[model samples]
Target: MHRIFEFDDIIRAVLQHVESSATDLVNVAMTCSRLAGPALDILWSRQSSLARLIMCLPQDTWEGKVEGCCRDYIVRLSREPTPIEWEHLRANASRVRRLVSIDGFTDAPKLPRGPVLRRRTDGIGSALDLFRPILRPDVIGHVLKRLFEQFPPATLFPNLCELHFEAVFGLLERSSKFWLLRQFISPGLQALRFDITGIPTHEVEQLFAALPTEAHGLRQLSVSAGNGTAALTVPPSLGKLPKLIRLAIFAIDVSLTRQMITNIQQARCLQTLKLNLCGTSCDASGIPLELPSLKTLYLSEGSLSQCTHFLRQVTTRQLSRINISYRGSASPAEVTAFVESLSTSCQTFEHLERIYVVDKSDHPDYLLVIPLHSEIFRPLFKFKRLSSVKFIGIGNFELDDRFLKDVPIAWPSIQELKFISWKRRAFYSVTFTAMMSLAFRCRSLQTLHLTVDATQSTTIPRAPDGTEALWPTQTALRNLHLGYSRVSKVARVPYFLAEVFPTLWSFKFYERYLRNCAADIDLRLALEKAHSQLGALRNSPYENSDKLWENDSDDSGT
Candidate 1:
């Protein structure tokens, strides 16, 4: 949160950081109705990413020209649309050149056949629909050819360090596709994101063949696969990107063919890697994956049997953070073993600070489950450098009483803690109590995040006699967040946190359940009250909470 100033010049800085804070923008708008348009202007100007704009797809925009659609497409159009309408429309062709963008994308049968409009979203489509104009097949291919042919020749911005193509994977394989991609991205491209949805097999191969072995300048590159079955080959050139820092890729088995692994081995400078082999992936036999500089790694899919091989093969001393996600099914015990073995093998990765093992509970097919085994800290207590932890969505039925025992011994350095359970009774569960006990046990604990399982029904607990257990003693906690699946009354949250974490500074409390989900103001008063309490905690006990709300919020003395 940022303070507001009456003078106009002060806001320019606040706007920079709060661009994504929609609620704060609304409050600023109400302060002066005139501020609404300008504030929106600042926020919408950022719809520059292709992904955000893709969300606007399949939906129509500005019927014909730029209008006030609150969708992503509008954000893609120039936030600074000149006043002269004819001139704006007239320059549509040239602006495409200057900005390196094409308004409409591929076409589908449902979309109208002619020229498309480019407002944000005044039409009827989900955020995902608005990409229709861009998803059109030929249009997508043309955008790719156009990008490669022109970017290398025109990129002049010194401040620009990265180039992100939102749905680049939309383009299919072609003869010169790899060459063209290399032509545009080879040297200057630092950050690249391609969405492979409808791509074909050969094209996938060509894309991989185009990986630049000499990409010494590459830093962060992400290639995603949207909701489509059209699989592509895994490019071996991927591992060869020179000085590659962070890479996020989703590929199928065909790309995992033997030779690509050799290329992967050649890539030794990688730091952070995220790989998702969602569907059937071929055995990654003899694929070279020797990443000595790697630090953080994330993988989705692959059995413990295969994962153990991959982890054992990587001889890197810097590997510290590991996030293993089990999408379809997996056993909690097996997952626990997989993680424990990783710690034992990657001994040089002594800096390992955090580990995240995500499992989906209800998928009966993968009847294998991670036990309500937080107390089964037996596998993890070995890592002396471990710290932060996150459990995304195990239910109450999966956990039991002895789960939280002996957790800190594995990594006495632990400080910040985040626990998210999808189980009901989390607030009242022994597991929750164990979590709290563990939170207080960590002498170095500074930031603690206790989020109830959002998928469950709501149940706020009260003390045995009427008051609720505030929390483990909050004296050591600096940042504490207690969130409900849905927003409750705002007043209830501030009182709870105030009692629990007396020194807490930043708080995000939800309370929209009582009213229309989108328009609820249940927690409005509570936020201001908390802020004043914060002010009081700083030792100014005399300040009035009501007055504090008037000074910062849009509410006037009236």
Candidate 2:
């Protein structure tokens, strides 16, 4: 007789066996009552929208009479569903572990149909103006109040862990609706993200102040002041959250930078900090702040001097990742100074694994490139454990010869590398011999992203002894992203890549079709076929056959 697995074991098996989709889990819940409890728990755990939950309410609770597209949405607010049993509502709502609020741009469910409110197009430049205007401020407030009043917070969403508001402040700024919605706050909440763009500083402060003291338990908090140049003050209560592990602040002015730095200094457990300096000048008051526990840092859109000052003050030795982005001119000297400072002050850079030097300039014609000076990148080469590196923006440098050749030798453990250049013709004359040099040097490379000119002839390289050179192959490389300058010669890409990267499983080829070419069609079909074939081999039955069918044979040595 075979033994049957326990209910919990079966549930775990179902969830863990494969990547189950939302529909698959819902199907599991409908299978039987024994399996439904756990399946329902997983299904309603992290809801992206509250619209679905609101729709589940009784039909009579919907407000206003309607016609056309909004006819079926009319109902009055009620504690319980009119015809459906209250237990049904309790079953689903009780299992909800998160409620993610959507911004105006999201196509959420219509609340009560009213006048055909035209989208305000006069001064509607912000993303908030794009809302469908279905759930007006008053309607949302009323619904939330009734919902909270009907079911006490403890029973309604006892296991709630995250409450994310994505640019939902447009509706919130009109009134103190957050106060009405405060009852939904749970002690176990781990993450909170608010993109309050147009809201006033005082109102934003009030919203932050009203948060339950459980805010102290939050592990991650991301706040972005969408309005450009408007200083969004950080509430004093948020500064001392002992359990907070990750904090991100964006679009803050110079005056608030001191307070922000002070808060970061106080947060003892913050492991990751991302600050969008919002073009704020670095002042004397913001210096001397320290981050002892920080491991990852992202600084973007700030003056070079300001960024350098902040990095000089912060103290951390365990940092593994650093990303810096700039919208304006980020001269190579400025960037080098920042890195050199870290090399001298921050002891944690020795463990750094990832670094991104990105330039997000507005005008594509105006190029902002980082010149690769040996002295500047010398400290970067010291990152022996570095695995990922990205250099984005146009530069006055050759990517194929010097840059690629030195990178592999310097960072032998590199697994991923990306270079985004403005000159499309940079790779037009690259020879196959030069390309193989990178693979030979960086044996651990897995993901490579850069433009290449496969149109050039595959010239045979000779060794010092005048013998034909044998190119080394990299089996670890799985993902290759290439931007081709010409498509006619793209058909040769598959064969060339197969030789250089034997284990290539994913290939992304980007090309500009100036004029229709037959080879472009072949390239797409070839890549699709390769992807499907590799996918089959990766998920074949033989993958885990040995585990399930153990070797039971016992051979006696005669």
| CA lDDT, every model vs. true structure | 0.46, 0.56
Candidate 1 lDDT, tens digit per residue, 299-384? 65544434544564455577788876555444555555565667655656467777765553345232333344454445566667
**Candidate 2, 405-432: lDDT as tens digits:** 6788778789877654533223344344
RMSD to the true structure for each prediction, in A, is 13.6, 12.2
Candidate 2: deviation at residue 122, Å? 49
Candidate 1 Cα RMSD (Å): 13.6
**In candidate 1, what residue range of length 10 has the lowest lDDT sum?**
549-558
Q: Per-candidate TM vs. native?
A: 0.54, 0.71
* Cα lDDT over the full model 1: 0.46
